[model samples]
Target: MPQISAFDVVGPIMVGPSSSHTAGAVRLGLAARRILGEPVTHADIGLHGSFAATHWGHRTDVAILAGLLGMSMDDSRIPQAKELADAAGLQYAFQTVDLGDVHPNSVRMRVLGKENSIEVVGASVGGGRICIYEIDRFEVEIDGSYTVLLARYKDQPGVVADITRILASYGINIAFMKVSRKTRGSDALLVAETDDPIVDDVLELVRQLQGGIVARRLPRF
Candidate 1:
């Protein structure tokens, strides 16, 4: 038998009628927002499978908007997310689309900021948990259970080692790390989940690395 945690038994503290649809949807949106690393000015959301079929009735749309606005799952404003988005100048639209061979509770979000943009694909697995599986065409596995450091760079020798060295120097323990590349010595995406939060100074150090394009920290959700 599989072990069960407190969260699995009691669910999450949230404004919700269902953990999978509402709470998980909120977290998915939040993950997208954090990965973008800037205020979301516009968002184009594509719902899939069960999410596409039942999102409106379950208020998954509202939950996603609340998260994009940086609201926690239990925020009282979740019910008014649409109005809030309009007031905050957040342009958004939602449509159903086939994401292909993924979880039923999946969604693809293309979020834009003033100077940056990101595309994220994620799914709400149950008990209010989520998994972010893709970011900007790079396959990843982020579960929002650890402080994550995302680095995008031109793939080259010693890049990963230097980043690990920096984290080690800061005494931050890495729980998991994955690097995905389009081709050898080409563009690469590194996903590092650390036991401790990555401070701003450390992030800046990583940002200054040769060939580093972007480095962002995503706090555990």
Candidate 2:
């Protein structure tokens, strides 16, 4: 006989199956959707390593699609995600790729919306946990455990301070912060993990700042 835990369940609570293949994959897709902040009209998914090898058997493909549709890990609709996406007119395709030196259970999604597109790379680290490692071309580390603020802006001096100032005004405490850029004076990305939710006003103010292209708040799933 064997023991079972919550993480083994594909759904909620009771044990079901592999957490890395099901729940973790679901969370990865959900995180990417939250970062995009819009309905995905198309998704070009790249499955890597173990994810590619076992995707079909584990239902990882459907899991990712369900997450892109904004479904939770426990949502029974996950199994029917393909049909739902078709009904919603969301186009999607999946391909296998070799992402060198990455985790075995990794996926890269290029999600396209009517107005914008986002590329996210993440790894399912098992036990229903995941870590997002990149957004677009910017390297990041998001564990989906905290309220997060993500902003894209022109690479210039004082922008970081300006964004932080707005958060301070909202009385929100910072838990962590990271900045990534391609080159000097180019577009840059800022990711701030917070102790509390950011208000809409503060988010708007940050978006209004000079060089601000986009600002989005991601709540923990």
Candidate 3:
């Protein structure tokens, strides 16, 4: 038998009606926002499966917009997400899409900022829990259960070792680590989940690594 946690029993505290449709959608959006690491100027969101079939009635669209706008799931302003977005100068659109072989309640977001852009694909599994599967076309598995460190850099030998070494120097225990690259000796992405929060100083050290790496921290939800 699967062990049930408190979240499983009580579900998430949220504004929308359904956990899977509303809370999950909000989390998915938040994950994308964190990965982008900037204010969202424009967003092109694609809904799949159940999300595409009945998003309007469940307020999934509004929930997603609310998340992108940096609102929490329980925020009172979720129902007014569109209006809030307009006030914040955010432009967005949603469309149904075929995201092959993914969870039913999934979304793909292409978000643009003033100086950067990111493409994130993820799903809200249940109880407001989400799994971020892809970022910038790199396959990954991030569940937002721990503080996450994301680094993008030119593929090179010893890069992973150096990163782990930095974490070790700070006594930060790594809960999980995943590395993916487009091709040998090309661009790569590192996803490291830690048991403790990574302070800005540590993140800055990661940014100073060789190969012009760009590093960002995503706090646990």
lDDT of 1 by residue, 124-167 (tens): 99878899999988999999999999999998888899899999
Across residues 25-135, which tens digit of lDDT does each residue of candidate 2 receive? 988888988888899999999999999999988999999998999987888788899999999998999999998899999999999888779999999997888999988
Model 3 residue 214 lDDT score: 86
lDDT score for candidate 3 against the true structure: 0.91
Give candidate 1 misplaced runs (Cα > 4 Å): none
Q: What is candidate 3's CA lDDT for residue 26? A: 87
Each candidate structure's count of clashing pairs: 0, 1, 0
Q: How does model 1 fare in lDDT? A: 0.92
The residue pairs found clashing in candidate 3 are none
In candidate 3, residue 91 scores what lDDT?
A: 98
Off by over 4 Å in 2: 1-16
lDDT of all the models against the reference? 0.92, 0.88, 0.91
Number of clashes found in candidate 3: 0
Put down candidate 3 lDDT per residue, 11-72, tens digits, no spaces: 56788798889988988888888878899999999999999998988999999999999988
Query: What is the full ranking by lDDT, best candidate first?
Result: 1, 3, 2
Which residue pairs of candidate 2 clash?
Answer: 9-16
Candidate 1 weakest ten by summed lDDT: 4-13
lDDT agreement of model 2 with the native: 0.88
Candidate 1: residue 188 lDDT (0-100): 95
